[model samples]
Every structure is written in C-alpha cells, then in structure tokens.
Target chain A: MNHHPTEPQETIVTDMPDRPALLKRWRPRGAVWLAAPAVLVLLLALAYPLAIVVVRSFTDPAPGLDNYVWFFQSAVNRTVLQRTFVVAAWVTLVSLICAYPYAYAMTIVGRNLRLALILCVLVPFWLSGVVRTLAWVILLQDSGVINSFLRGLGLPPVKLIRTLPGVVIGMTQVLLPFMILPIYSVMKGIDTRLLQAARSLGAKPWRAFLQIYVPLSLPGVYAGAIIVFILSLGFYITPALLGGPRSILLSSLVQNQVLSLLNWGRGGAMGVVLLVATFVLLAIAAPLMRQKHSSTRREA
Target chain B: MRNFAGALALTMTCALALPVFAQETPVAGAVKEGSLEGKTLTFVSYGGIYQDGQVAALQEFVEKSGVTLLNDGPTEIAKLKAQVDAGNVTWDVVDTADLPPYVHCGTLFQKLDFSKLDVSKIPPGQVGECSVPAMNYGVIFMYKTETYKDNPPQNWVDFFDTEKFPGSRAIDGSGDPTGGLIEQAFKAAGGDPKAITPDDIEKGIQKLRDLGPDTIYWKTGAESQQLAESGEADMIMMWTGRAMTAAKNGAAYTPVWQDWLVVMDQMTIPVGVKDTDAAYALLNAYLGQRSQEILTEKTSYTPIHMDAKPQVDEITASFLTSTPERIAQGYQQNIPFWVENFDLAAEKWNALLSGN
Candidate 1:
C-alpha cells in the first residue's frame, strides 16, 4: 500500500523529441494490427456465414419475408421452436443440479486427488460425440443393456426410445462434460478456509456451504449453464434419434427444411432464428456474467 | 408403319453409337498402368449397404478409370447446401434418399441428359429429364417368423391391428410425414395411398397415434435392425435393407412385401459441378448391367437395369419387391404428385409427425 508519488523519474529514451506524440500514435495502431488476424478469422468463420443466412432468409426464392412467415405460421416449425427451448431449459437445470455436488467435491478434495478427479470428469473428451451418442443407443433402446438388466430382475422394460426422457438422458450425457469442467474450475479456486472459519463460528456445514461456497462458485455455474443451454439448443442427433415423434427441435427442423423440403430460405430462416435466440440468451447473460467476473476479481 | 421405321432407325443409330460411347467414356477417367491417380472424386452416399453396394459395384471402374473415389456421408442436405453456398462442392455425386432431389430440384441437382447413355437398357418410366433412378428400395412391414409360426401377420392390415398382434412394433421417428409406414397404414385403412390428401395424412397419423404406447420408434436403419435382432419388436415397418440385414444376422424375421412403397435413389449432377464429363462417364458405368447385377447380389437393393437378374436366396428374394410377384403388389412412389404438392406436403407432414 505504498501510495507515494514523491519521485519523478527521467525518461531514458527521450532521444525522440516527439515521444508523447509517437507513443500516443503508435500504441492503439499496434494493438489493432495485433488483433487483425483474430478479427479476420471471426469475420470469415462466424460473421460471413451469419450474413449469408440473414440475407438468404430475407431474399431467397422470390426475395420476401415468406420464409420467416412460414416459420411462424407452420405448426411443425412452431412446435420445434417450443421443443428447443424446453430441452435447453431442462438441460441447464439438470446440469446445474448434477454438477453442483461434483464441483463441491472438487473443492474439498486433496490437490493431488483433485487432478485425478478432474481427469475422470474429462475422460469423455477423447471420444467423438457420434461415438458417445451411439453408445447411448446401445444403452437406452427397449431391448438394450439397460432394459435387459432391468427386465432380468423381473421388472418390465421401459420404453426408452423415441421418448422425452430418452432425449434428456442422451443430451445430459452429451453435455455433462461441458457442465462439469467450468463449475469444477471455479470451485477449485474457492477458499475453503472460509467454510471452516464459518463452522468454527458455530455455522452448520450446509448453511456455510450455501452462504460461502455456492455464491463463490456461481460464476462457474452461470458459465456452465450458458454453455450447456446454448449447446443443447443446437442439438441435432440425440433429439432426432432418441426423442419421440412430437419432440422435434429447431436444428432437426432446419435439417428437414433443407433436406426433405429442399427449401434453403426456410432452412436459413430457422438457422437465423436459432442464432438470434442464442444471441439473445448470451446478451441477457452478459450483465450477470460481468458482475460475476468482477466479484471473482474482487475475491481474488 | 412410321413408328416401326423410327424404332429400327433409332436402334441402328444406337448400335453405331454404343461402341464409341463405351470407348470414349472410360478414357475421360483413364487409368495409368503403374502410376498414381492425380484427382480425387468425392462420393456422397447413404451409409450401410447402399454405400457398400455402390462402392463394390464401382470398384472395377475405379481400377480401370484411375479416379480415386473419396467416400463421404450419411448424406446431409444441409451440408450440401452449405458447401454449395461456400463455393466448395466436395461431392461429384450425392446418393441421397428419395425425397431430396424432388425438393431441391435444379438448384441442388443438374438436369440429366439420357441421350449420352443407352436408355433402352433401363427399365421403363425411370429415366427422368432431371434425374435417373439409380436403385430401387421398398419400405415394407416385417415380422419375426418365430413370433407367429402359424398365425403370422400377413398384410399391412394385420400390422395395424394391435389387438390381434398384441406386441410392440417399430416405425421411424424421423418426423417424415409421408414415411412409407404411415402411407401404408392409410392405404390399409382403405385410404387411397396415391391420392393422399392433407386430411388423409392426418388420418394416417392418427392411426399411428392409435398404434401408440406399444410402438417403438427407430431413428436409423441400424437401429431398426437392432430392434428386430433384439426381439423387443415382434414386428416393424422397416426399410428393405434393414429387414434383409436382420434376417442375415440370424433374426427369425421376414418381410411382407405386399403393398410396399418402392423408392428410388436418383443420380443427378448438382447444378454447378465443373466435372460434368467425368460425372457422365460415372453415370454410364453405373448403368452397365454387369455392375447392376453384381450390386444386386451383394446388396439387397434391386438394380435399375431391366435385364439384370439379382442372385438372391429364397428368403431375400421373397422380401424384395423386385421379385416378379412382389413387384405386382408394390406401388412406385409418385414423384410428380410429391413434387407438385411438396410445400404443402412438407408442412402437413411436419405437423402430423409432431402430433399437432
């Protein structure tokens, strides 16, 4: 906390007479050049396709608002949109519920043991999404291993395929890694001494956890929720396979529009709608995320 | 008669043209004796037997033609559209399902020229101005032969009658409204399958919902086979290949080819393919009877050529709509009707599948 402004230092590189002008002129320009490649990549990968989608959504196959209108008016499209939100909300909630305990465990575990646990959490990362999804098929089908084991014990087999439960189970499986890692990373940095301190002061373990650990780990929770929710919204395969007839998602609809219907404009419109919904969620998340970020910085 | 003279002259011209066409075509895809092939031809096709048959049939062509075939798929139309938009057409030919070519039309696929190939070799009514039917598949009802040794469900009507069958069945959960199963159900219930109106589609879907809680939905061809193999499903409305595979995998199941929906995979050049000559040569090779016959034997799929006799076992031959007797019962999917009412059909189909 040395706040002394007592010493004035002489500039060593004052050989340039216009040093102030030179510094002012060159710094932001240098930063811009440094950022140019990243900006260009983003433009190429993200912005350009998005621009095309937006354009196509507006001007394709007669250049009118018909595609957008079709999306809103079509019962199938409306149902799919509703289903997407429902699935996203459920995934976020489930991931939150499931990850909290694991995240808490990561905090209290020994530092050496935490690395092993973290590795366990990340083991699925090495497998392709399609492979993991195929594994879910082997596990969840009517006569699959899960049902067979259940039935062997004199229990009736549950109709797992083409049901909402199947979709949620498959999706939660696909996105569990996304949910766990962020929460674990945040929890690991929490000062557990505060919980011990609270306990020493006669606070119960649950209360202390609720007051200290839960709030502290919320940045990770928020991050994990957004990651899970956003990813779940765009889920294509799991919902298409495992979910029942009525459980159509926006991604599947976009595929149907492009492939089955052969209407690119309609597909593009659905894509833009999906993108905008995600963007809106992210936009709403920004203020809370910024506040959490600041609280994290302050805690640090 | 003028028709006789015209036919004779046409035959004479084609006889003269055949040798030239055959000789000049493969040279475009000419192989070097002991040198590496320079270019890669990307092939987009549906997975499993469809791809297996196609690649197997074209193996000799690849050896002779010297064009390296880069296989890619479970063909996604959205991916094709994206690639086209990006100005990167990776696939020279895309062997997709029946409905896509009709939906995308000239935008996604090129209008094919039949004059380049010998059309007389092909079956009647398959050569389209825009597309050529490459292979035939049927969507038919299947049941485990062991399930009802004496009282087996025989027809589409029996498939819908849950009371008599008293077991779960598998249908596609892909939300394809006009998926062959639903259409068959409609037809079995005395709705004219060909003249399916919006109301008829609704009725058909209601019939599906009635079949209801006992129904299991399979998403992929492999899943359908697994359903049959595991014996969870006593019966299923399945694609022909899956039914064939299930039987091959020692499942005691057999298909009811009666009133089956016959579908064709069309081979058309996409609108902006640069290698049209190579595409044409590939198309010509694909039309050859030897290739078709060999493909039919290995894969359960029927060939497009009229002259090719498929070498199939009794069970598989019984299952195939291409068999003389089964062919009579099966109906060709009316592409014109589908094309005309595509937008409406798409919307209605989606609604029906979504249970709206």
Candidate 2:
C-alpha cells in the first residue's frame, strides 16, 4: 500500500542509525546504574547478615562443624523441626480452605460488598502481630471469653490456651489475609464468561465450576498456599503466645539457643538449616509456579 | 578546600585531646555534686516496671552528678558478648542476673575497683568480684486462696504435688533454666535442696515432668501476674514483686514463703565502657540509702542497702524479703553451680519443654 514512500524512507534512513547506536551504548549502563542502589542494599542488608550467620554457625566458639553436628544429633532439635513443618502445613491448608470461598465470593460480589469483604480481610493485617496474637490469648485462655461462654452453656472448660489447636487457630487467623489477598487478586483477573459459557452448554453449575473455573484459579491457590506455608514456618509470636511448651517450633529453639543459653553457634546453625529448608521448599514450588504462569499466558 | 581541611584537622585534634583531658580530671570515689559533668551514662536493664523503678532510683544521681542518664533495654548476653568481642561496648552499666557476672567476669565485664564502690552498706556475699547487688527479690509460691480455702499449700513440695494441689500450675519459663526451680524440684523429690548439683538436675526435671500436663509456663513477669489474677492457674511460682502486683490487682492469693528462693539482680560495668569511673560512680549511687529506699517503695523488690528501711504499705511489707524472719525462711540460689552447669541444664530444659 505504501510502495511510493520516498519521503518516509529518507526520514527513516536519516534518523534510525545514530540514535539506536547511542541508545544501545547507554541503555545497559543506565540499567546498571539504576539497579545499583537495590543491589547495594541487598548486599549490605541481606547478603552480609546471612553470610555472617552461616559463618557463625561454623566458627562462633571454635572453627568446626560441631554446631551443625549437634543440631542433627539432638533429638529435641529434630522433633522441633518436624513440628515446625507440620504446624506450617496445617496452617497453610486451613488458611487455603477458609480463603478459597471468601476469595471466590469477592470475585463475584457487587462493588460495595466486595469492598466490605476486602476490608474484613485487610483490617487484621493492619494490626501488629503481637497484638493480634495476644488477642487470641485473651480469647482462648482458661477463664477467657470462650471458656466463660462454654461454662455458661454447662460445658466443661476446655484447655485451649497453650495447645496445638490454639496455635492452629491463631496462626490460621493471622495468615488468612496472606491467603485471601493473593487468591482474590488472581481470581479477579479470571474471565467469568468461560464459566457462563459452560453453563450455557448444559453443564451443571458445580460441574462448570469444577471443570472450568477451579482449574483456572489454581495458580492463585498455589501462590497463596506457598506464601502462607513459608510465612508460617518462621512464625514466632503466635506459637510463643498461644502454644504450650510442647508446641515449641524451630524458631523458638533458635531463640532458646541464642538468648537463654547464649549459644550463638547452635542458634546460627538452626537458622542456617531453616533458611536452607525454606529455599528448598521455594525451589520445589518455583517450577510449578512458572509452568502455571506460562500456561496462563498461552491461554490468554 | 584549604579552610575545610584546616577545620577538619582542628576537630580531629580536639577529638583526640578530649580523652586525655578526661584522664587528667580527678576521679571522685563518691558521687559528688557535678563530678560527672558533661558525661552521659547508658544504663541497661530488663525493661518494665523494674526498669522504671531503676530509673526512678537513679534520678537523684542524675540531678546531683549532672550526668545525663540514658536507658536501654532487656539485656541480652549475646548482644553483650558481641559488643565486647567487637570492642564496641555501648552499655556502661548493665543490670543482669547474678550468674552472668560470675560466668563472664573479667571478659565481658570489668572486675570492680572496691575503693570506688561502697560495698560496706551492701549485704555480705551479695557483692561479687565483677558485680554489685542491684536489688534482692524472691521466687515464691503463691496460690489462689479460693483453690486451697481451708488447707493452703505451704511450699515447693506441695507445688509439685498435683494430687494434693489438684489444680493447674504455672512457673517461670522466661530465660535459662533457673537454679531456684531445680533446687525446689530437688527438695520436692526428697533430695536435699542444699546439695543440688549438675547430677541432680535430671531428677529435678523428672519431678517437674511428674507435675504433668496441667503445668503452664509463663515467659514474662506480666504473664505470671496475669496467670495469678485471671485464675488461669491455681498455683503460680512467680517473683514476690509480681505476686504482690497480682494481689493488688484483686487476685485472691496467699503467699507460701517457706523455702522461697532468694534471688538478686546484679549491676556490672561492661568491659570496654567509655567511662569506667563514671560507671562505678553510678553503681555507687545506685546502692545509696535514699536510692535503695526509693527503689523498694516504688517497686516491691527488696532493697540491697543493709540500713535502708522503706516505708511501704502492709501488703508491700508482707512481700518484701528484707525482713529478718522472711530472710530466715528463704533459700539463697546456688549461683556458682548454675553458672557452671548453665549449658547442660539449658539443653535439658529445652528438651523437656519441647516434650522430647
């Protein structure tokens, strides 16, 4: 259509060559310069401290692997680590179970109702972790509000404070927002027309949701689950406040070593192990995340 | 550029010359008026009402000595070790448990100059080579009056007797394994409390385990007080000060002072402090008669001054460990034994806590 483009061709030939060369020369340098502050911050704040912890695990009292050896050999440490993972998994699963319907409702709700639902999810996030955990303590403690209500109903007072169920309840409440927000964000982006079309094609509502909508919304579920799990692994305050001595997690162990015993080597070793375990979990989840992202892109 | 360089050089010269000037100044063994002028001392302690009382006790010193006093937090031994290791000690005087001074003496803390500190007024044996007693307190058993209406539990043995007590129990689980707990446990298990050793630690822990699943652990003074006030536990082993506070807060509790564990907080100068003499002067001022009296009145902790008498209410006086009768009934902690066996005991304590 533009075969006779003599004027445009002359302008393009004159302008394109030197400008691109100049841009190409400076672009990479500009990018490096722009990224320098973030890189420097990471090196100073994150990498340096992490390196110190790693080094301290080996060399605090003496230069050896005795700390790590002790960590593995100690039955207490092993049990605590196992308990930490188990609690984290339980919190993740519970958060996901509760967050799924709430997030799905948010995706399909009216504007005002959606805002209200979002506020419900976000208000707890605004509170401090310590304050929230303490609130749970007040509600769950013996002679606390829940126990008083149970007593009023002629029921025996249950041991809720400093128990496993108490910890799960507190952690689930704390991490629910983490699960809901991610799923809501992803669910909001999903097309509702696909579900409607499935229903129009004679599929039942439940069938349509299960066959079409749930599959599409899975990336969000995976993201929420991973995030909640990782965050719950490092939970300190909730478990400390709500869980009993038997509910001591790995973080508590680290605190015990570093603070009480003043054994930095053992504490640092526990920290390194937790960090490695977190990374391994992330590494396993990363491939699934990437695959889901690519499939979503292809569908789009 | 020349002007800036000249100014920088002059500043550096002044910075290097100041310490020399300070060294030439006469050191006052006593906290004389304005002796520590233009100096600031950072006082570190376990924060809360205790630290508030400490700050209150130091107010007179701050006024008289003109040393601007700054306060810092819940003392962490690891942080202190790091500071000492790095030669960057910021805390001039730290309030800590009695055991740390004995454990890290001459390394993390300075061995005191007895001439600078007026140790004559303090109780004998409360003074250490590196530390001086800050305040005296006790870890005593306090039970809900309603739970044991006619026959109240009397001592640590009754505390361990779940069948006799027949209620939930709470104990301090804040820091390292406390020697008081072990001593009490040993006593309860029919072992001699005075003969508690690293060997007896296992049996003590076993006795605690026998107390069973109704045992609750409180990590803070406030939590222990709350445990008593809220009726979360029937019997609470807590500080005398906290138990008093709980009673003041309307908790119907009665104290069992028999074999109560006598504990004391100690103050020590960190190793590489900026001003050693000033820190010693501060410690001296803290042990003053007026300061100790004020501390005892403001906080329910017992005063270390041998002659200081605090005008406290009847309730407060009932909890004070200073009186001769109460002191006779109390048992002093085996600080050296704990300082030596801290690590092993801590490991076992953690293992038991984690239910392994």
Candidate 3:
C-alpha cells in the first residue's frame, strides 16, 4: 500500500489470516526454561547475600534495632555518610563535565581517531582500580611526579595527596569512562541531520547544537550520571588510598567496623542505609528522566 | 548400574589399600617424623614480604612433618569470628597482632597446649596462654638524619616536642589507637606508659593533637616506609622492620632507639580449626630455632627465639630488636592492659581520628 516510486512491483503475499493460529500455538514454556539458570544465579548470588545482610543488620549481637540506632546516633557515622554523598555528587558532576566534550568529540571524529580515543578510555578500564589509584598516588604524592615537575618549574609544590581534592581527582579519573561510554553510545545514535536541518533553518551552529543536539543527548547524560554516581558511592580503594583521615567515607567506616572491629551488625546497617539511599536517589531521578525522554521523543 | 557397582568396588579397594601402603614404619631410633602425616593446615598471616618469610620459615615443618601447608590472608579477625560462628573454621593457625589473641582468648582462639610446644627458647613474658610470640619488633622513632644531625630527637617526649623537632612528623594511623603512639603520648603527657588507664587515653590524644597540623599518619607498614623514602615527613614513627626496609631503600633516616616501643606478633590457633593437634604441631615447628633464624634472615624482623643467631648483614644487625642489649633498653608493651582497654581506646581513637 505504501510502495516507493522507484521500487519494482511484485506479487503480494499475505500470512495475516494464519497469524492468530500461529500465535495460539506459541508457548512461553521454552523461554521460561531458558531463563531459569539466570534466575537461579540471581537468587543464589545476589538476593541471598543481600537478604543475609539485611537480616544481620537487625539480628546480629542481639535481636534488636541497635545497629541501625548506632548508625543514626553516632555523629561520626552521620558525618561520613554525608561526606560520602557529597563526594559521589562531586565526582558525578565532574565526570559529566569531562565526559560531555570527550563523547561529543568521539561522535564527530574520523573513524581511526575515534577508535584511538576509545582505546585511550578502555586501556585504563582494562587496568585494575587499585593499580590506577596507585598510579595517581605516584603522580600526586608530595615527592611524586607532579610535585617534582612543579619544583622543576620553580613553583611551590602543592599539597595533593591525603586530601579531599586528591580523592576527587582520583575518583573522577577512574569513573570518567563509565560516564563517557554511555553518553558516547547515545550521542552516536543521535541523527546529525536534525542539527544540520536546524542550521539550514537559519540557526547558528551553537544554537543548533544547544536547541537540537543537546536535548537528544540528555538520556545518555542521565544514564552516565546514574552509573557514575552509584559507582562512586561504593568506591573504597581510591578514597582510602588518596584521602586523609578527614576524608574518610561511609565505606571506610563499614570496612573498619566489619573488618577491624568485627562489628558486623553496624557494618550491615551502614550497607543497608547506603543501599536505601541509592534506591531513593534513583527513585527521585527516574520520573524526571522519563519526563525528559517522553518530551524529547514527542519533539523528535 | 553394573559399571557403577564395579567403580564403587574399585574405590573401596583403593581406600582399604591406603593404610596397607603405609605399613613400612620408620626405624625407632631414626628422627621421628610425619606427626602431621596426611593432614593439611591453612596458615594465615598478613601478606607481602612478611608472609613470604613465614612460608620459607615453615618449609622445614612442611617437609619433616609431611603436612601440606596452604597459605592465606592478611588475617581479618571478623572473618575468623564469622568462620568460627558458622562452624566452618578454615584457618588453622593465624599470625595476628599481639593484642587480638589476648583480647579474644578462649573465644576466638584456643588456649595453646604448652606440653605440645617447647617455649624454652622464647623470651620471657612473650608467651601467652592462647598464643606464642611470632616475632620481636618495635615501633621506634626514626628521624631524617639530615634534618636533625645537629640535635636529634631522643625519646617519646622529643618526638612530641614540635618546637624542638619542628618539621612534619608521621605516626602510625593505621588503626589500633592503643598502640605505641598512645603509649608514647601518655609518657609525653607526664603519665607513665605502664600506668596508662582508659581515662589517660584522652590526655594522650590531647598531647598528640598538640603536635597540631605538623603531624601526619600512615595506615600501613608500606605507607610508613614510603613516607620515609619519599621524604614526606622529617620524622616518622615506624615499625623496626619497615624502618630497616626504608633505610635499605636509601632513606636518609637514623633510628632513635631510646625508649623504643617494643611490639611483637603472636601465632594463634583459631577456635574450631579442623585439626587442633596438627595446628599445635605447626605452631611448635614455627617457634623452632632454625625457623626463627630463617624468618629473621629473610624478613629483617627480629627472631623470637633467644638462641636464634640469625646471620644478618651489617645493615640488618643494626635494626634487629631481639639483641639482648636492645631488649634491655626497649619498653615492653603492656599487652594485658591494652587488651583490657582496646575497645574503649579504639572508640575514642576513631572519634579523635575523625576529628569529631
């Protein structure tokens, strides 16, 4: 019914009459069977441990809510929790700022350069987080390379290691790829023709990019932010290695309680709180993300 | 079904034949061996060069006793507790801080069988009901020789005296606030280190805080060594072993042995270990003179055995804490006092570290 003018016409075939019969014969039993292994693995590996953690948070040392109470009551625990959120938020924002230009460059670059850029991101990805953190330590420590270079330039060496700034820089570097990849993937899917059309319609290049291209890339930014934010919240090694005593995070507190003090209930309670906070953040972000997506889809 | 039955019968025959194969007993007068035959024990220790030395030291035990030794850890006390609680205790023997075995004695660890162990060679006051001294070391004040060549800091009080020893100082911040830092702090505050009470801990913290922003902390032995090697701090309170390592790596630092805080690691048998007898045997072998000597030679940690004459190079000999003269000069850690007050001290320590 909607044939293109240049197309050669051919005899039409219809299987519509037999569609209901075929649909009636189809069963979901095979699909369910196929998914059974994955479901089992999720139950065993993820759900079981999570359930135990939740239970231990309530029951350990004695069957009471003492652990949760302690977490809320302790000024130190509360401060660390607040600090963790702040650090994660800062890392997410910084990653977003860095990743946007890198991803946009990836979208417009020649194939080889794009591949090279991707490799630059992925090479660090292949390295272990601890190795990357240690590399930062070597670069940022007082006698490390950066300070050495500053001294060589006849400049005073800046304090970098064992500081909040050092932790943020280390986290941002490690989490940059997590932010970039998602945004790049989405930006790659965005049609360039729309921006070109905006340009043709007498809009300037900057306006065309701002009005047309950026709206389409919002989904990628949101996805990347969510991923980076959640990951930064759970980060232990980078912050531990880079941050000073003042820069201690909730995960560090959890590690101290669980590993050093052997206070599992408190650690479990802290973990549960972190988990709930992450869920609450995602819950708040989800509807806003959905609204933006639907509006963008309507405009497209 | 027939094939299954045949396979089962073959397996049963092999099982029965195992004892028969071991029927050739050794001569009565020959060196008695294989006390731990057909047994496997997991030995846990803090990892890195120290653990490497431990494995090397225990090689003779593994060979002579015919026990298969599997190594694991950076020992976590929580993990040990969890394993014991779950009735699946996997770690047979654990090398741990001197305090934990004392604090959790009989609950987390078994009371060591003294009859099975020969503790004669171990230094006096080092052996406990539930643990044996694994190594002798110290948390000694080490300052950059270049910085203080004219007037070096001598004792704990000099370390805390920022005006006299002015540059940035690094102390043990790796946790366990009840360590030498507190002991030294107590001494610096005109309180005797031996007479330290939980109430005096706050005074110690105050004394340390008086050092102000000029003080830093290192959480790991490696970090302590790095601080010295990289010249981050003018003065560093470091473990003797790590100080030695940093010195060997060309850190221009000289140790101040006056009133050095003597510390030791303890070997423990975790409660509910699958084979208790084998664990004791392994512990016994670990404390042997040859084993201690090998440990000292390899790791630069001072040997526990008084008779262990470790063939150390000149550099290593200078750092060894087990020497009779050094031991006489060193201040022994009051283990029982620390053990009794660790939880209270740790809470206060954490709060202080957090700047709360």
Candidate 4:
C-alpha cells in the first residue's frame, strides 16, 4: 500500500497554492456537475425504458385496464408468477445453506487459503452465464454424467434436470459467491476476542458463537438474501434450458406475450406487475434491512 | 399503379422504373449489374439450415446487384409490428413460416406489388395479398430409425400411441405448425381433421399432452433439429427443412411421411420499408428459378417455381416435400381455421406446456 513513488504528484498538487482555494470555491457544486453525466445516463438507459414499458402497459392496444385484466385472468400467468417467486426463494435458501460454512471457513483460513477459496468462487462467477448454465445442463440431463455416476453406484438414476430442485441447484452454484462474499466480508471485520470473552464468562463454545457471531452476521445474510432473491426473480435462460415447462418462470411468460403472441400491451402489463411485485418486496425488506444495519452499527 | 411508378421513380430518374409498369417487364430481379451499388436490403427468416440456404440462393443476386445484404432474424410478427409501428422498419423482406400472421390482415406486411415480381410459374392459390409463398415445407413426424426399427409408427394415430412404441418425443410447442400438428393430433384423438373447429383445439392439445411424460416440447424449428441431432428424442414433429439438414448431418431419422402435411411459408416486404423497389428487387431475385433451385437443393424444401427441379443428394431427396407420391397424400393447411383460432390454440398449447 506504499505510495512513496506518487508523493511527487501529491506535492505538485499542494505546491499549486490556489488548489485549496479552487477546491473551496467549487467543491459543493462540482459534486453535482461531476454526477450529472452518470445521472443522465441512468435516466436515459434505465428510467426512460421503464417509463415506456409502464406507459405501454396502460396505453397500448387501446387504453384501459384490459391488459391487467387479461394478465390476472390467465391461470397460466398466475401459476408462472408464483413459480418464479418460489424458485427464487428456494435458490436463496439453497445458496445460504451451501455458502454459510464456506464463508465462515474463509474467515478462519490463512491468507493464501482465503485467496484460493475466493478464486474458486470468482472463476465460475465471472464465467458467461449462458455457458455456466449449459454446463449444468450437461451434468444434470437424464443421460448425463450425474446419472451415469448414480447408475455406477448401483442406485436408481434420479430425476434432476428439468425439475424445480435442478433450477435451484444451478442457481445456487451461480449465486453462492453473492452469499459467500458478503458473509465473509462481515465475518472478517468481527472482533474474535468477543467470542473468547463469552467463553471466559463460562458460556459453552457453540452457544457463545451462536449468540454473538450469528447475530453479528445477520446483516450480511440479509444483504445476500436480498441480492440472490431479487436476481433470481429475473432469471430467464437458465430455467428455460435446465428447467422443464412445469418450472417455467415469469420472464418466459413475458417473452411469450411480447414475441410469440404479439401482445405488447399484455407483455408490458406483465412486466409492470413484476416490477411492482419487486418494489413491494423491496419496500417491505428495506425497513427490516435498516433495522439490522443499525444494530450492526451499534454493535460495531 | 401510377403511385407505384411515382414511388419507383423517386429512387432514380423517370426512366429507372418505367418498364416496371409494362406488360413486358424485365425478368424477376433482372437489373443492370451494380445499379444498386451502395443500396442495402435486410433479409429476415426463421434462421438455421433454411436461412443458410436462402443466403446461398441470394449470393449471385446480391453480388450482381452490388447491394449490401444484411441478414437479421429468426423472424417474429410482433417484431415486424414494432418496426412498422416505430416507423423505422429496418427489415426489408421477412419470411414467416409458423402461424403466418394471417390474422394480421396486411397490417404488418405490405401489399406486395405483384407487377414487380415474377409470379407466373408459382402455383395457383399460393399468392396472397401481402406476400409470396417462399417454399413448400412440410411439418412431418420424423422418428429415429433405430428407435422404431421393429414396427415403424405409420400415421398420426401411431404418433400418439405411446404405449406401443414408448420413447421420448419432441413436438412443436409454439404454434404446433398451426394446422398440421394440431389437426393431425385432433384426428388421432378421433376428431375430424377436415372440419376442425375451435372446439377441437383442446382435443388436439389433449392428444399431444397425452403423448406421455417423456415428451419434450420444442419452440423453434432449430430446436426441433437439435432434438434430432442430439438423439434426445425418439420422435420429433419437425419441419422437413430441418429434418433434411439433420439427416445430412448424420442424424438417423426416417419421416413417417403418411398423410403428408405441406405448408408454404410466405415472404413479404414489411409495411414501412425503406425502399419498396429495392425490397421488391430482392424478393424477385429470391423468387427466381435459379435461387429457388439452390434453396430446394440445400434445404429440401420444395421450390415455388414450377420449373425449378433441384438435384439433391439421397438424404435430401428423401425429405423433399413435393414428391409426386407424397403430394398425392398431402393435406394442405387449413388456413381459415387457423386464421380465426390461432390465438386460442396458442394459449391452449402454452397451457399444456406449463403442465396444466
């Protein structure tokens, strides 16, 4: 972290004595100007398209609430929407189960081993999503390696691909890094002496760790849960290839409406529904997250 | 007619499209070589082996015209609608195979200028208000040879009989080749294939869904071919175009060509095209006998031009939809039924796919 080589540049900036005066004059308003380009880009790319979709949901193919009525009336749409949330929740839960011990281990590992653990998470995490999902498809198919291995073990070949658990497994592998990194980062910051103090006060080892460390890790778990659940909701390709028709999600329904059915109004309405559902979930989650955030802050 | 001439003349001098209005116009896509230099046309289709053949068919035409040929899609009518609605129609010519947007009623596709095209040799009733028939492609049931070597499944009844010849099957889930698959399935379920009503759609989908739990529903022609190539399914209800390609590529499949169901996919200039003359020129070239020959040769989809006889290899020959023997049994598309109830069938098909 040494920056002795860059001291000359820092000295040069300080040598220009008017630099402080210039900074004092422009600091407040310069912040807004500096942020303007990013803010404008966000508005154009994100907000504008969203606005079009929301507007189209209401106004397209003759205005009214007909699209909403259509969406609600379709039993298939309701089923798919429910399936999407359920799959997302399952994926989040699966990732948590797989990631918690790995994250805890990472906190207790030596520096080199910790780096190795992170690399294991990152290399696959940075791989193309389509490629990764396709790899899972290869492993999980009926005549795939997993079934072959199971058959070799004198066990009946289990149905994994095109099932709900198959979707969760593929999603968990991709999302475990989200779970691991957050929990690991928070764990790394915790004071280990507190656990020792609990033990010194005659608390059992498991109880001390659970009562102290587990509460401290709640913020990270919540953050990871929020990310994995929200991201899983929007998943399209993995489920399409790896999951069967019974596991069809909301995104596929949206695609069916917009592309196949040529009903953009219905698609837009469906999209607006997804957006509203996500926002409502987020609104409920925000206060819970804030409360956890403040408790963590107080503990720190 | 005068407005067409005016529209044509807008591109160049008064003489450029003058002879286009004459009874003796130039042959389809016949132009002074390089006259269309710097011009562009975007060709859109249900891509895969078929689009590749189309691109090859247009090679000389594109080269001679010196027009920059831009390739685009796996076409969708909704995308065509969006392009037209936005008033920035990038796609010049689009090929729609499944569901043909017959209910679109000439809104998304232009009313093609028959004057500009060479439709003389094209079969009667093949020409529509907004488009020309691209090719005669059959959506037929093809089964893996080794899977059913004992006693081959013969007709739609045999196709739905899972207990007799049980193996995984792949069939069209999107549109179900509209009439062919559904009508056949309806008949297989003991309904009249000839007089298929909206009420028969559920019966058809029910028959399809009854194909057992081992069935996979394919959404695209390419996906169906992938099913063939991967040997992922024992039986596939797929296009002859894809079947031909798959067989040539070493897929072991034999079409149970009974009750041959033939359909001609249509080509159209989208409603708000950039250059009507240029777009028409591409369409004309694509419709020419030589281009049609190459297309039939490569894809085994029957040529629209009556005189274009393609010299296909044995594998391609077996899958050809327009054979005299096959055509004798061929059931042409029930377009009217589909034109009215395409959405209903699509919904039911999707519901069946969702395992409802």
Can you give the lDDT of residue A44 in candidate 3?
A: 100
Least well predicted 10-residue stretch by lDDT in candidate 1 chain A: A1-10
Return the clash pairs for model 1, or none.
Answer: A162-A244, B110-B269
lDDT of 1 by residue, B1-356 (tens): 21323443554465447766565433212333423255567777876767888888777777776777788897787788767777778778887667666567667777555445555666565655456677887888789788778888877888988888877777765545445655667876778877886567667766777887657666677878877888768888787877888888888787786678777788767767767766766767777777887778888788887778878887667565566786788767655555656566667666655656
Candidate 3, overall lDDT? 0.82
lDDT of every predicted structure (CA atoms): 0.73, 0.83, 0.82, 0.79
For model 1, residues A63-147, the per-residue Cα lDDT tens digits are 8899999889876777778889998999889878888888777767899888887787788767777888778877888769999
Can you list each candidate's DockQ? 0.39, 0.55, 0.41, 0.40
Query: Which residue pairs show backbone clashes in model 4?
Result: none
TM-score of 4: 0.87
Cα lDDT tens digits for candidate 2, B1-356 = 11323443443444345546454422222468998899999999998888999999998889989999999988988889889999998999999986888778789888776655566667656767678789999999888899899988988889998887799888788767778888889888999967777889999998988888768888778889888888888899999989999988899888899989888999999999989988988988898888999899888899999899899998899899988899789888777677778778888888878776
Query: Candidate 4 regions off by >4 Å?
Result: A1-33, B1-21, B46-49, B144-147, B174-177, B220-222, B248-253, B297-301
TM-score of chain A of 1: 0.83
Q: How many angstroms is residue B278 displaced in model 1 relative to the true structure, after the best TM-score fit?
A: 3.9
Residue A208 lDDT in candidate 4: 87
lDDT at residue A138 of model 4 (Cα atoms): 72
lDDT of 2 at B46: 90
What CAPRI class is candidate 2? medium
Candidate numbers, best DockQ first, in rank order: 2, 3, 4, 1
Model 3 residue B272 lDDT score:
89
